[model samples]
Target: MAAKATEKTNKRDFLNHLETYLSKRDGVDKLLKISRYATKIIIASSLIPETTGSLIPRLKSFESSVGVSRKAFRLGKFVQDINALRASRWESNHELVLLLIAYGGEGFYYFVEQFIWLTKSGLIDAKHSKLLQRISAWAELIGYVGSVSLKIRDLRKLKDEENCVASTIEISVSRGMAYEEEDEKMKKIKEKKTLKGLSIFQDLADGLMTIADIRDGKGMLSAPNVISSAGLFSAIVSTHKNWISC
Candidate 1:
């Protein structure tokens, strides 16, 4: 089980950590290794008799046991409960990945082995309704997209810098000073609050010429900013539609 959150930290701690993690060399290496191992597993499973069906269908019950049961666990009561679940820590992505693969991986493989056994012994009844399965997948896809927007908002909280949202508006008004072009107001107007490199799916290119236009004093908001923003937005929508199509 994962641990519960006793204290909620600022959203910056989470989003920044994910950004840093995905950017690191060691973190990428681990994900690559995990991918390689997964690929090998799938390839090996292909050698299994076709009558056994897809390995994924066999893993459904395993997901219920190993993935969903963390709801019952409390923080600190179990060494690893729901709270133990975290995205990569910004400082130690490699170490964090190792810990999850160590603790979480054990439960994952154990249940998968159990699934194989039950299938072999004819003790398992595969009873997932096709419509229910489709709905579940659809709901999960919706939740996944919502989570992307949620994290984007979490990153937006990062612009607050002082954790001032829960407190008074005075915190923001008090520390204000600069009126320079580099000020927060300018950044917000440019819509580049957080790091521009947050996601690879978005880039300053494509309509990157607009950035030059702003520099040349053409207009603050021009065709390229609108075009690039619309492109990125549509990328997300297209991805969702393509996923559902498959």
Candidate 2:
């Protein structure tokens, strides 16, 4: 009983330490920076000519309707505005709160573009289609960046797995080669193990490629319409939530 209690205490302490580490302002900033870069890379790889042609024209139409210049649309003004509010004292910003409400709308746009791609490609089933649409609507309404943070966690996990698989492949290959001169039977066993490891590495590489493709599609979809909506929503909700509770 004493041992079990000690183990539980240790686990709680470890979790507390982890939460503290992750919650620090610097840690959050670093995570955000990493996510942004990952998203950029994904966008670059997924933007095929056909996808670009279809999406860009629609994005332009949306921009024109909103009366935001093409340059402002591209520059993510909403994100900038929310970021400014984040730095300011939360007590005095009602406009920022309204912006947060609209931020959710922007996030909806991003999800819509993603859903369109998935639906057209037949990657997502019809059953989940409506659910995704609803989630997108809520995201647009909420605009808190929490959903994006969950996605960032997924991306980071995928990246870490890819690295681990690569390392395993390298280690297996090195061992196989090192033991090649010992005996024919041993060499065959080592070679087989190495080949299996290589196959796993290749599969991981393909999965990473797919992630990159998804990221690209998302970034391109983030025109001012979606981005602004999300930014405004995030600002309002975060500020208001903080204010009411404080």
Candidate 3:
């Protein structure tokens, strides 16, 4: 019991350190650049040409107009807004809430694009489409929850640091992380294991690769898009990893 409590305390300390480190002037500046570059890579790779008839604006409009309840549409719109905000430059505290939003939004959209295709594929192969949908549904949910909750937490922390009144939304993000699915949960375990703060940086490479695979599998990538995105992300992810190693 004591050991587990000590572990919890250590994780909290790590979070505090992470928040402090990222809040530095340089930290925020560098991350903003990183997010901008990442968004560009994703767009150039996946969206513009692939969905020629229905790119971002069109897809977003269609998604909003889908047969759904008012509440569902509102929720979907909120999710979509996060994606739009991700590309727009913004400041964030040490928690990197904005970066998390960009990430979650990116992941969500990637899966969404695939799901849209899967919807189209239903007429051709319902069985395969159903399987893909099942797999992506959980991933989409994770991306959504992780993205929004982290952003909310970051805002709350900012409020506290800036000399504000007490907050009411007491959703402990760390605790919530404990209950995430195993594959995602395992990443959290890895986070606690090293506590070096380098692994989070490594996630850039992993995420970009995941994006590439999904785009390719969905037959959404043109030859130019594939070559450009793969080369760009590989170079960037490699440079960062090398710097971290040194």
Candidate 4:
């Protein structure tokens, strides 16, 4: 009976968390991204046999619409980066370098994406879309590189801290002292390490997609299915992060 009650509580808590996650703008955007990439994967993959020619076009259209809608949803998102940059002005030089590259590059990418969205929406000349997309792709690539670098550096520091905390815990245990505080600290560090690792993975996946975009889908990593898979992976990681925060 207790086990069943615990299971019921867990389910209710999960539902509440999901409700909160889906309520936020970022959560909705990530969900849309997941849907968009999943649709792209279906359109690109052979899961839908050649005999089902009719579904391909429709799926492609849906993917395209979702892509445009995502951009629309992200309209003015560069403002967030602007705010981030402002808040980080007092950080260390090394931190500032990464922050500038990551936030500035992504900010510009988002800015240019607005133009691409306009072009796709027929509000602007189609001739300029390619150039804007190329610029956005490059900016995104740079941002991802900076983000991955920053996360790796942070992970290394976290590892060092974890080691120190472990040694302290060992000493405390040997001396028969209470180490609950150290244990709690270790848990927090491990959680941070996990999140940072996820961030790096997400950034790498996104970087692959950006590279594929810049290369016009002609290289080894530029296969349609590969791009879609990377996009979906990135989206899922981001959604997971957002969900946990929610």
Candidate 5:
């Protein structure tokens, strides 16, 4: 009876958490991102037998629809970077520069993406679509580059901090003093490092997709399967990160 009750409690807690996660804008966006990339992967992969003539086209249509919806969700999202840039002005010079490049690039991408979305929706000239998409891809590439560089620097600092904390933990343990606090601090640092590493990987994956776009999918890296796989990996990593935070 006790075990059954505990299981029920855990299930209820999970459902509540899931509800909370789905309630946020970012949460919904991440889910849609996952859906969009997963659809792409299916369309690129051979897992589905082509005997079903209409399946691939339907999947492509779904992916495209999800893509447009994701853009709509991101409408006005560039304001976040504006605020981030504002807050970053007082940071270290290196950080400030990277933040400027990263946020500026992302902001411009999102700003231009609005028009691209409009063009796709027939609200703007269809002739402008290709140019706008190219510009957006380039901006996204720049933003990811800056973001990855900044994260690498941050990871290095975290590594140093982790080493310092580990040394303190060793000394405390040898002296037979309480080391619980140091141990906890080390755990937190490790968690942060892990998250940062995941973020870097996600950024790199997204950057690869952007490169594929900028190159018109001509190179080896731009292969449909490779691009879809990278996009799906990025979506899963981001979704995991967002889910945990929720």
Candidate 6:
């Protein structure tokens, strides 16, 4: 009877983790799509003439492509709006892209942070630990994407420096150097933050892995057995109900 109960608990924990994993994946996908659209809008507004007309149509197209509701779309717009407010004094392409990149980076960071919290809180179980691992992988991938996009922007700035050499060469050169320095600083900061986030994720992954390894090897481990049992499910359901009520 005890053995049968342990098996039942293990199965329940696995299913619970699976559900959480799927939900997190869906959330990540939605955010990634939103980020891509935001990037497009930032680039379009910066490069295209007649900002409002060009921006609105392209934004609409992106909206259609992403299939996000107006309310959800407004969230992306809110990030842009905040950036626009900040860059109101200096209207330029660089400002737009920087704001977009910062906003997107922060947004991704927050998402990962939330996932880390969820995992640490035991809201996520061993089976879902695998999903958390994947989430960490995705976070790294997103960081690389942001880095590449910033690099392209840097290259474009270099091209601009070459174009107007005679009149504003010295100033352009100085400005380019400043931009490069700033970019490097920002890149280092972002890398540091990403590493920190990855560290937290790795710690959580390690804990989950340890749990899994113990469960697989030991036929009966206290933590896994407790988490796998009906008691754990009951606690989860109760906590969820409380959350909904609150």
- Candidate 1 Cα errors over 4 Å, as ranges: 1-124, 127-129, 162-246
**Against the true structure, whose TM-score is highest?**
5
Ranking by lDDT: 5, 4, 3, 6, 2, 1
Worst 10 residues of 6 by lDDT: 226-235
Lowest lDDT block of 10, candidate 3: 162-171
| lDDT (C-alpha) at residue 11 in model 6 | 64
Off by over 4 Å in 6: 1-106, 121-123, 162-246
Q: TM per model? A: 0.24, 0.22, 0.26, 0.90, 0.92, 0.26
Top lDDT hit = 5
lDDT of 1: 0.39
Any idea what lDDT model 4 has?
0.89
How does each model score on lDDT?
A: 0.39, 0.43, 0.46, 0.89, 0.90, 0.45
Ranking by TM-score: 5, 4, 3, 6, 1, 2
**Candidate 2's residue-wise lDDT over 1-246, tens digit each?**
999999877664655555764665334333433343333333434453436456545544443333222112223334543554456443335544544443444544454546644653467776776666555444443443333333344455555655565566567687775433334444444544544344333333323332333354265444433443333333333333332222
TM-score of 1: 0.24
245 Cα displacement, candidate 1 (Å): 36
Tell me the deviation in Å of residue 64 in model 2.
22
- TM-score, cand. 3: 0.26
Model 6: per-residue lDDT, tens digit, 1-246? Answer: 999999887664655554564364333343444444454544434454556556656655665544333223223333543464465442578755654554454355345545544554466564675565456445434444444454455555545544444334356566664345544554555544444444334334333433444344354432433322322233233333332222
The C-alpha local distance difference test score for the whole of candidate 5 amounts to: 0.90
